[model samples]
Target: MQKELLKWLKDVGELDSARLISECSVDLLYVDTLFEMSSDRMTDLMDAQIGIPGKYYLKLQLDFQKEIKIIETQLMEVATALGMHIRSISWNPKIDTDKEVQMKISIIVRQAIFDEITLNKISWSGRLEEPDFLNRIFDLSKMPSFDSRFDNAYDDIHKHRIMNYDWEDDWVFTDRRFNLLHCEEEIFLKFLSLTINPVSRTDDEGVGQLIEIYNRNLSESGIEFYEKSKIAGKPIYGYREIAAGNASTSSADAKQRKIALVVGCSQYEFAGLLENPLNDAVAIKQNLESLGFDVMYAENPNLKDLKIKIDDFGTELEKYDVGLFYFAGHGVQVKGLNYLIPVDANLKSERTVEYDCVQVDRILSHMENAKTSVNLIILDACRNNPFERSWGRDLSQRGFAVMDAPKGSLIAYSTSPGKTASDGEGKNGLYTGELIAEIKSVNLTITQLFQKVRKAVMEKSKDTQVPWESTSLTADFYFNRK
Candidate 1:
């Protein structure tokens, strides 16, 4: 890329910085006023003799000792923005002119052009200012704290138009000049990507946090900033356009919009207490959290409080793209409706038990109301209801009623409808234990994730318990995609 940029620069022979800016349509608004003045100071900076078109070299005074690093970095940026490369900066030395003797540092460089991909490959779509994403950037760019970052971005991507333009509070007076606020999508994305790079962030925590904030908005435009790798615990960020319905591996991490809620009702008040529900909830919660979900966990929650948590979770789900609900406890089915027994339930009779317990459909209702991109409802509560003996119910079905999964949802059952699932002799239930194990595997989509769990459970249970899923999912999903 640097070679090509240099070649492009060489083609435009004997060019001055002003001409380069005007021809290339660079944006100069982001440049510091004093530095912009220097660029404007044609007599000292842009004169052809000093900024000579020979193997990329820069000539600067050695007087500003303290600001030397700052000035050198900025000048190199100007050199770069003008499609030129200033390779190295050497100390001042005696110059041999017929009538003068002075010291001036010389840095060799080659002419350059902005990357072709950044300049012409991607055409401008809508106005760059149309998205609110830039609002944060614009505000931050003007702050004193962010000077270290925006300084590099400004000089790295400046443009030329009128040789002398007015100024307003550091803004270029001529709106006609190309500026950061009204550049192409390519430049906007490239500029933003540079700001979040580990080198640009001064090894601060801002890179990670900013990437999260940027990706949330960038994804709406079919692009995202991803952590390409890490350097000393800091993320090295990059950007790419994402295909529709197919998010990248970086999209599968915590920066994306995803959340989970896990509940366990083991400590019963009037119903038979179970052992593995709490354990199962913890297992699922841990796995989901590890897979980049903001998991909300509930243990031994009562009907009233659980309902409130469900409502809150639903409201919160509005802000996320994916939502998951996992429940493990004693469950009962009557008249083809499933109920999850709460720790505070009083199941005196089959008729009133519906009022005492939590309905499975209520959870689905909240997920749907939130309008999430995907919803997962996993039920490990297909246990025998102790009330069946007292009610004298003698049907073949012993567990939850069968139902179809809703649109954009995938519901998982610990056992096929109307079958019982063992709470297990170990810390976790037979179904949840396998599910957690499979969730740790990367590149497994939602359906594939459950299929593996079903197989694992089937083998472990010796075909006594078969996990099942009902999915109406419109897009593929991964718990830990790579």
Candidate 2:
């Protein structure tokens, strides 16, 4: 790329004639006026070196003695005009002497410039602004304090295009630009976005079809499975996984054969609804460990912390043959995307919902990539959000729903999509109570358990609240049926 740029530079004009300064250095300089610079100043900074017929390059730099905030403000303006956006920033600090700091700064700036030029949405014409005079305004308050701001700034720099993308384009960020910015021969390029294509996903509709399958197969033991009953210590058909695995592993000194993660959130501020999903998590953990499965539990994890936990679990997932993720909490479907809420989630806006809450797809991505042979996700989170209650939205809205569970995975929801589940007045949820009953029964596959749970919940709720399941299991699995 540099070779091409150098060649392009030689053809346009004399190197010194265009006020071009190659490898220019600055000292004790600070740039504070970048935020308030006019458009002409930016034009001046463009250094006006034409490239490849009509293209241009702007060599920009922010020095150590300059205020990062000022530099950021100026960059944003240029990015907006040029139809560029910032994506992210990864920085390494220099703790050595002043000279080392300066050298590191130059390297960082040069690398950033190279990256920007090579980026699909941006082109480097030349040094539009001088680095020498611009480095003197080092006001410190313009820098960001948190990592998110810096990351956002970089994202903005990389992303700020005037146009949206086309449907046929690859959605992968690394493959192509999300925005289009091309220069016409007359320099009449306008960053205009194309219309967005409608989303074609209809998986939510499939949940209803799945419900019919369960209702049709409700009574007969189409696939025999069950939880153990306490009174007779006999296995009953349709037990949840945690119960069977927990019971068998109890007395054995050997490591538990399977591991389960139970996540729950109940203390919703708007409605003040509480079912103690955490308490259920504790119960499930203890009972599962007793039966032979190593149980790990997290209750109402902060939204900020959930991803870290998920990532950590992703690594540990390879350790077990079977991986189970169970979530019981409030869920909401927004803009066609499903979000699992943390106790701290405050989604006042649709955009906020997408970023802060855990997306159903992200969880699937981790699980599908995991090496575990069996991946089971059990969600009992179908409570309604209080903030949207007054908006006249359906109260029957179920929590998050997932589609297309991978070939080795099973996804069970507490209630059908677009329907709400009841928080049992009893110790556990109605579905969980039945789940606890069935899991104690040995020799049940997850498919059978889900089918049975669908039956029990439908029957127990008088056909009002139906459970849902999506599975692509390739092998039979049992906690204690053997």
The whole-model lDDT of each prediction reads: 0.61, 0.50
Count of residue pairs whose backbone atoms collide, per candidate: 10, 59
Q: After superposition, how far is residue 295 of candidate 2 from its true place, in Å?
A: 2.0
Query: For model 2, how does the per-residue alpha-carbon lDDT over 113-133 read when each residue is reduced to its tens digit?
Result: 224334423211112111111
* Residue 258 accuracy (lDDT) in model 1: 87
Q: How far does residue 464 in candidate 1 sit from its true spot (Å)?
A: 1.0
**Can you write out model 1's per-residue Cα lDDT over 267-370, one digit (the tens) per residue?**
88776668888988988888888777899988898888888888889889999989999899988887888888878877777898778887888889988898
Q: Pick the candidate with the highest lDDT.
A: 1
lDDT of 2 at 202: 20
Q: Give lDDT: candidate 1, residue 115.
A: 26
Best by TM-score: 1
Misplaced by over 4 Å in model 1 are 1-255
